[model samples]
Target: MDIQHVCILGAGTLGTRIAFQSALSGFQVKVYDIHEKSFELSKKMIEKIAKSLVSSQIYTAEDIQLALNRLSYTLNDQEAVNQADIISESVTEDIEIKRKVWTRMGEIAPEKTIFTTNTSYLLPSSLASFTGRPEKFCAFHFHDVFYSRVVDIMPHPGTNMELIPILQDFGRRLNQVPVYVRKENHGYIFNAMLLSFLGAAGKLLVNQVATIEDIDLSWKVNFHVPMGPFAILDQIGLDTAWHVTHQLPDANSQAFAALLKTYIDTGKLGEKTGEGFYKYTSK
Candidate 1:
């Protein structure tokens, strides 16, 4: 199918970024969130990011204006999915919520619309079944676009193999490096590795092996990377990190979950909220 109009469901952190990238790539973008207020917030976020891109010289004023012009925000489900060639779902990582959204999408979306999920850890196989279009479903996992530009495309057992190249080309159009995953792996390839690293880092903190500050410094000095595991947790949001930790079946995982949950409960939700493992007073 010749994809043109892209509908992005959910306007949270990742959703807005995906919408921006799609619009920048010259796709007609439609954004939908369950709550009208949430969708409004996403619009503000998109505007903010567009200005930042201009200031950073990554995009020009005309470029930002053109991209914004291609984007539309809507609350009507049928209106959002109607005539859309690609529907990218970027809701929270809750399985039940994902299933519910997919069920609705199946009911409202056109038959030829390609369905993709932006879930980090959940398997797309079960979710695809809920969509009533398993063969047309796949996981198009993306990292934070500011730093990471790689997207993992993992298909379920029922997914059509012919759709892989088309999705890959779509990824390239959005200026992302698409990595195709052959097997059905929860978290795909990159995230699986990242989660393991995060688990170990959480263990070190919980076990009192090293301080968070020192551990972060050690990794930075050695690997020459911009951020450490704790910093990454901050970027991922404490609530999100807690959700990931809560799913693990280990004592260390439980401890990590508790630690993150404490911060979340206290209203410190990472960079988005100003504080998490560390405080971010400024950008």
Candidate 2:
């Protein structure tokens, strides 16, 4: 299918980035969120990313302006998907919430519209049936659309094999490296390794083996990389990390989830909230 209109079903950090990049790729994009405030936040985040792209000379000022012109925000469900050739959902990481959203989308979206979820840890099979069109649904997970540009195309058992090439083409159009997940897996490829690395850092902190700074320093120094696990967690958002961690039925995961809960309770979700494992200055 030739995709021209893209619908993003969230206005959070990742959703905003996906929508921005889709627009930059010359698609007419609409971003939908329940909360009106999320639109303002998404816009600010897009502006910040646009500035970086400009500074890096990845895109010109006029290019950014034209991309912004193609992007839009809305609250109405029907309006969001009315003309969408494909929908990329990045809603909250909760199962129930996602099921409800998919069910509604199945009802309102055009019959020709393709469904894709940007869920971090959830399997496409778990949510595919809820869409009322399992063959048309798949997981097209993206990690940091610009910097980390790999997009995972994972299909459930019932998904049509034809979608692979279509989605692969779409991912490339959005300037991403498309990776095919042969089977249903929790964290796909990179995230599976990432979860283990981050879990180790959390274990050290919960066990009092080292300070967050020290643990992060250990990884950075050893790997000769800039950001460590804790710093990376902050970028991923503490709430999101907790959501995935708390679901694991392991003692170490439970301990790490509890640590994350304290930060969340105080409304310090991460860099988006200006704090997490470390404080960040607002751009």
Residue-wise C-alpha lDDT for candidate 1, range 132-223, written one tens digit per residue? 88899999988986559999999998999888999999999999999999998977898899899999999999999999998898888899
**Position 143, candidate 2: lDDT:** 99
Of the candidates shown, which would achieve the greatest lDDT relative to the real structure? 2
The local distance difference test score of model 2 is 0.96
TM-score of each model, paired residue for residue: 0.95, 0.99
Give the worst 10-residue stretch by lDDT in candidate 2.
274-283
Decoy 1 TM-score against native:
0.95
Angstrom error at residue 164, model 2: 0.7
Using TM-score as the measure, which candidate wins?
2
User: Candidate 1: deviation at residue 124, Å?
Assistant: 1.1
Which residue runs of candidate 2 sit more than 4 Å off their true CA positions?
none
